[model samples]
Target: MAVIITNRSLADGIYMMEVAWEGVVSPGQFFMVRAWETDPLLSRPISVHDYQDGVVTFLYQVVGKGTAILSGMEPKNTIQLEGPYGNGFPAVDTPLVAVGGGIGIAPLYYACRKFKEDNPKKKLRVYLGFSNEAYRVEAFDAIADEVVVDVGGIIVGQVDVKRGETFITCGPRVMMDALCQVVPEKNPVYVSLEARMACGMGACLGCSIKTAEGNKKVCKDGPVFPREVLEG
Candidate 1:
């Protein structure tokens, strides 16, 4: 169990929660979070928004019963967390381009930070899209060479895919599909997918997604995958 350091609204329905944790967490990985014991039954899988010092942050949208419960909790409240699970985005030498839509921006923040840390000389560009109000768009300024934000329109259209660039994206399925269509054959694009999960481990088989290599569990094999494998 982790204690809530802070849980506050960033915007309407969007909340950022910081929990006390000292675990090793990778970008694109998530934790199965639950603030209640008996009522909700299962935990919600929330992606790592950022991790620093001894605290891990989660940027989550209050969409349903579970998240609503989470949003109501105050500081010092104890919540259950089960993981830093699944395969994370890969570190690459190529110029990095990150695309996020709405709540999808959660994981990419950490991924971009880690990328810049490892490849200091390489360039990183970020694009964020929101249907309404945008939050934390300013935070990317520190990690990105350039940051572009779009509202109420196609955010993917803003990205200029180039040769030898590595792209990482998470968002609405339609937006992700649009991105896949434009990326050149040589440039590699990786996507993070969301799915409802039960155990958060491979044992439940609740988050299986069909891929080129049969079905893969999102909670186990990935919440991240190369565009090619998903396309296959």
Candidate 2:
């Protein structure tokens, strides 16, 4: 269990939650969270938005009962948090391009920081998509070389896919599919998937999906997978 340091609404139904946890975490990893004991039955999975000096933040949308309860939680409230689970985005020396849609921006923020920290001279580009109003864009200014936000239109379209580039994205499956349509096969692309998880672990088989490789568990084997693995 971790203690909530702050919980505030960021946008209409969106929230940013901060908790005191000192464990090592990687970009694109997630945690199973819950403030209640049994009413919701299963914990909700939230991605790591940002982490620094023993504090971790999560950005989420209150789309249902579990998240609503989480959003209502006050500072100092203790919550159950299960992990920094799943494989994280890869660290590469090549120029990094991160594309995120809506709440999917949560993990990419961490990825951007990781990239900048590893290679200070490297160029980093971030593309964010929101249905209308935008959020957390200013946060990118500190770490990214370039940041572009698309409101009301697809952010994927703004991406200039080129040969030998490396791209990473997370968002709705439809948006991800659209991105795959235009991206060149020669580019190394990674994607984080969203799924409803019952156990938050691989044992339940609830988040299983077929890939070109075979069926894999999103809670354990991924949430992050190479685009080639899914396509090939």
The prediction achieving the highest TM-score against the true structure is 1
Q: Which TM-score value belongs to model 1? A: 0.98
Per-candidate TM-score against the hidden true structure: 0.98, 0.97
TM-score between model 2 and native = 0.97
Of candidate 1, the 10-residue stretch with the lowest lDDT total is: 34-43
Candidate 1 ranges beyond 4 A from true positions? none
- Give each model's whole-structure lDDT: 0.93, 0.90
For model 2, residues 1-232, the per-residue Cα lDDT tens digits are: 8999999998999999999998999999999998997898889999999998999999999999999999999999999988888898999899888889999999999988988999998889899999977999999987898899999998888998756668899998888878887788777889999898977779999999999999989989899999866775
Error of 1 at 137 (Å): 0.4
Clashes of 1: 0
